[model samples]
Target chain A: MAFVEARDLTKHFVIRRGWFARPTVVRALTGVNLEIERRETLGVVGESGCGKSTLGRCLIRLIEPTSGQVLFDGEDVLALHGEELRSLRRRMQIVFQNPFSSLNPRMTVRDIVAEPLKAHTNMRGSELTARVIELLRQVGLNESHLYRYPREFSGGQAQRIAVARALALNPDFIVLDEPTSALDVSVQATVVNLLEELQAELGLTYLFISHDLSVVQHISNRIAVMYLGEIVEMGNAEEIFHSPMHPYTQALLSATPMVDPETRRERIILEGSVPNPANPPSGCHFHTRCPAAMAFCADEKPPLREINGRLVACHLHE
Target chain B: MTEPLLRIEDLYVRFRTDEGTIRAVNGVNLEIMPGEMFGLVGESGCGKSVTGLSILKLVPHPGRITRGKIWFRGENLLEKPESAMREIRGRHIAMIFQDPMSSLNPVFTVGHQITRVIRRHHHVSRREAWERAAGTLDDLGIPDPERVMRSYPYELSGGMQQRVMIAIALSCGAELLIADEPTTALDVTIQAQILELLNALRIRRGVSILMITHDLGVVAETCDRVAVLYAGRVVESGPTDAVLQAPAHPYTQGLLNALPRPSARRKSLQAIPGSVPGGIEEIPGCPFHPRCALADDLCRSKTPIMTPVDSSGAHLAACHLIGKSEG
Candidate 1:
């Protein structure tokens, strides 16, 4: 069995315009299915409103999924309750996209990192302080920064503090939702390197969710392409980058501006933006803007099936 | 050779905060030829945006262009009066920002905004202005330009809104377009569309574009020539192919090495040590010396001037260790 698995995960948000208006369902996650092996990074790549964030939240129960089964180490995560859920929370942590906003502005670095430890463990006073310092040190920060507030730090330093806090509980799995997106390229490299080092040392698994294809390809062992809340393609990172089966994935990879000027790919620009998730298309949600979309694409919802050693959800592959 | 379209010499911008005077753009120089896509690339607080804003004299309050010679078509913009500058804006030069939604007025319809700028710049009938507005939107590849003109900004998607912004910028038949992170908020596919649209506009209208962005990939793909901005300074300037392929400055090289490339999977990225210095905390000599791998005593004491990297003299970098070899 995979170390972590999500089956038929779905989420729908009901938003009302006004008091007299009827609530509309925004289908954030239609049905996402994937797996992550032990100490491996599963990259979830998609554009805005594709429900990548929602999927990350659902796996950790941060947002309640309408229907799904999340398995952690052969156990049903959705079935946990009370202290069981609390202990599971300790093992699973999350880092948000924006570090400055994620870290409490008023709280000092020590307290922010220690808050998780305090809630999950009974260690107090000097023992907690020592642990917090050790956590900061592990993230390349020193004890001198213990008393500094989040506002006193740069975006890179603030992100480090967030990582220190996430590591406070020694989580076995972390949902990194665009952790490096808000950072500069140079600083993003530091954080990415730190995450790789910590993963090697601690044997931690990462759900590295980002829109940056290059960064995703660099860090992830497996890559899953999402479009309109559906997993369109899943395979080894290298295979997905080199030979994308789905049309959306192909367009996304082509549209990505490569750093090397000599190897510019022929861009396949999609006609329109992502459709409104609240009222998605009839069948394949991506059919409206897909370059190779056919008539049946609007009537048939493709199923995720294994093809050529990878999973693809498209009639073209069939 | 023909004269340069826009030339900035010894430009300096400063913002006076309570902490100290933040030198935003310090001793920056640039030259944009006609019908060229010039990229000003940098990280946050590197003054790329400020430099663009300074070109149009649009620096927000508390920030002042303390010293600069903005020469546009052999005329110094600084010597122009406020009225002359206003006349030049929109009629000769136009700018678009990163967020089209915020840049656009929410209450007014798109047609109202575009026609207003049209009438402001040229002597035209209201009917003609509206017709031109629809024509510009049509030229930008917006489907059903009539409906888009009648709709408010909120009714449009991000990509559509950005296209509308471009229409407004180009409606006046401006010669130079200063786009500040125009496609940063867009998705990759949408960004590609916008970039293609910009390139098409350059070719169709023969308008010079000054693209300000932090993404080197964007610069590599679209820009003909590029300039690298550090903390308030231009550290490198060269043809895009030369600078990207064989960067002379350590800061430029560091930034390129720091990016996560697909070919270097699982390998450790060469992250530059330390973060960018804050605005108030000024560093002497080379601003990047603190983070540079090749910093030495000479680099710590004296700022290097821009030196030619090759025989053509088109490629340039400001670094003390440019020609030195490590012992």
Candidate 2:
């Protein structure tokens, strides 16, 4: 079994209009199937409102899924109740996207980092202080930052504090939701390096979620491209980024400006904004904006299938 | 060479905070020829935005230019009175902010917002301003300009709002546009459209653009020349192609390597190790020495001045490790 498995996971939010009227459903995750191997980073790349964040929330049971299975160690996450789910949560943690907003402004850095340990363990006094300090140092901050509040630190420092807090439980798997996007580019490198080092030393697994392709490409071992609650493509990062099969994937790659000027890439500008996720198209979710979209794309949904050793969901490839 | 449209020399901008003075833009120098795109690339707090803001005298209170001369069209802009700057701001220079939602006035209709700029600059009547605003909106590829004009900013999408922002900026036929991470909050497709629109406008109107961004890729695609800033200093400056092809400064080199290229695969990106120092009194030697791989004793003790690299005479970088002129 994979380290993490989410099969046909679905989450829907209902928009209530009136007491007697029927509520409208927003299908955040229609049917997401994914597997992350042990000690590997799985990147979930998508634009806004694509349910990748919802999927991240569902995996850790932070937000309850409407249907399907989220298997960690062959046990259904949704089914785990009471103390069972609490213990299961120790192995899975989440690092949110906005570091400034995620950290508690009222609490000191030491208190914030030790909150997880205090809740999960009986460690107290100097032992707790030492552990919190160690966690802070692990993420590249010093002991001097222990008493500082979230507002005292910069964006990069706040993120380090969040990372320290997330690592306090010694979790095996972490859901990193755009962890570095809120930071500056120079500081982003520092965080990226810290994550890589920690992953190597601790043998950690991560489901990295982001919209920035560069950061996603740098950290992820394998990548899954999502659009409107559907996985358009998933493969090894090298395969998906370089030889992207799906048109959506191609357009995304071409749209990004490269750092190198030697790369004379003709940009593949998509026609319009992402369609409203609440009222998604009938067939392929990406057909409306896809450059090579076929007539059948509007009528039939493409199935995720293997082609050239990569998972792709496009009629042109299949 | 043709006379440059805008030239800045020894630009020293400072902001007074609770923690003493912050050196925002220190001795910065740049020139943009007419119809050319210039990029000021740097991480946050590197004064890229401040440099852009200084061009239009839009730097907020307590953040004042201590020393510098901003020459636009053979006239020193810093010497101009508030009245003169008012005429120069919308008539000659306009700016597009990072967030479209906050930048656009909430109460006004999109049409009225754009017409306000057109009327202010061109002295057109209200009806004429509205017509011109509608035409400019249509020019910006906004569908149903008439309908969009009546809609509030809250009613429009982020992309549509950004397009509206661009139309307002371009409504007055401004000669220069300072885009400060205009598409940072947007998605890749929307960002691409905005870039393409700006590129098209430059060609059609012969407007010089000063694009400020942290993304090196954005600099490469749209900018003719790029100035890489570090600790309020221009650590590297050159043609975009030259700078990207062979980055001389250790910071610039690290930034390029840190990026994940579509064609390259690595087990781990070689990340630059240390965070940028915040609000230091003064930087000794090189500001990047603490994070630089090639830093030596000399780099830690003395700052290096920008010198031309032999590959191209225009390519300049401030680095002790790299020689003054290397073939």
The candidate that achieves the highest DockQ relative to the unseen native structure: 1
Q: Pick the candidate with the highest lDDT.
A: 1
Per-residue CA lDDT of model 2 for A259-286, tens digit only, reads 7655445799888798887788888988
Please write out the lDDT profile of model 1 over residues B109-131, one tens digit for every residue.
Answer: 99999999999989999999999
Q: Looking at model 2, give its docking quality level.
A: medium
Q: Would you give me the overall lDDT of model 1?
A: 0.93
lDDT of 1 at B123: 93
lDDT (10s digit) by residue, model 1, range A162-219: 9999999999999999999999999999999999999999999999999999999999
Give the per-residue lDDT of model 2 (tens digit) for B1-327. 799999999999988988889988888999999999999999888889999999888899899999999999999999999899999887789999889999999999998898888878787799999999999888888789999999999998888898998888888989999999988999887889889999999998898999999988899899999999988889999999899888888889888877766555545666677767674478789888888878889988998888887556899998986673342
Q: Which regions of candidate 1 deviate over 4 angstroms?
A: B325-327
lDDT of each: 0.93, 0.88
